[model samples]
Target: MLLMHSQVKAKTPPTGLMSNTEQDQQFQVLVEQHKGILYKVAKTYCQDESERQDLIQEIMIQLWQAFPRYNPQYKISTWVYRIAINVAISFFRKYQRRKSSVDLSDPPMYITEPENVEKEAQLQLLEQFIHELRDIDKALMLLYLEDRSQAEIAEILGLSLSNVSTKVGRIKEQLKRRFSNHKI
Candidate 1:
């Protein structure tokens, strides 16, 4: 089980006025607590390693900017997912526009091979299928795959609960067909 980093202590700033150091410490703690979500979002949206890293950095920056306004009423994971997914979608859109003219025929090679080749192959195929999905569907599938509750997924994605349920069913059927058709 992954554990969040211990919170760092900083001198309390005046009410409604966080010192830079205090703000940094607070942001660091939040990021440490939610970094896996950020990475998963980045990876789902970006196929290229460099682009994935860029997306992660961009998400962190956006999260930091939005941290001060975060409402404690909502779960932190919900807020993080909302921001991370938005940033990822934006990043992907910009990246697609920029790369429209570039040749993407040559795929980047992975340096380290997984010890379990069969499991890695299956994961790769799943990722490929996920990348082929529409943006909203991709986000839905990511949250679903994480075993999040339908209500939580709906809240994070700003969809009605019924809509989330319907979309999840459709997405699962789509994945099932893809997996059945492809011998991965």
Candidate 2:
């Protein structure tokens, strides 16, 4: 399912709040429409399935909360993405801080199956490499995956075009070395 946030950039948001039933229906439609964006955004922020699933649920909750005051004048994709980034960054930081003590954690705190051997190895290496990147590199990767334009990325991330250009160049070099080294 996907959400309605696809490229429909808005000049002014929709003024009215949706009724509970209407909101539910709208949310259902959005979920059916834009689930892929949600999934990708979640994956970028998390290293495991449980966390990814949690992020999706969390995004759903945030969407519900934001729906009432949703300024539809803006592109739904942009607005939803702002929320997704906020949530993912905050959640990842918090989880990292918890230090993941076993006593307070669930038995199934992580899932290890890869669905396939090749996918498993690739994911393992990818995660390791990604974790070793700088914060800006991570943002670049996220924007790239979203297919955002250099201008759009600059706007969303508040970077100068030249600065982004340089960083992306550097990120490419680092990523190449990462792959070549075959070490995290």
Q: Who wins the lDDT comparison?
A: 1
- Per-residue lDDT value at 73 in model 2: 52
- Each prediction's RMSD over C-alphas, in Å, is 6.5, 6.5
Per-residue lDDT tens digits of candidate 1, residues 108-175? Answer: 55635567676667778888999999999999999999999999999998899999999999989998
lDDT agreement with native, every candidate:
0.76, 0.63
- Each prediction's TM-score versus the true structure: 0.78, 0.69
**Candidate 2 C-alpha error for residue 182, in Å:** 1.8
- Kindly report which residue stretches of model 1 are placed more than 4 angstroms away from their true locations once superposed: 1-17, 91-115
Off by over 4 Å in 2: 1-17, 91-124
Q: What lDDT score is found at residue 66 in candidate 1? A: 84
Clashing pairs in 1: none
Clashes of 2: 15
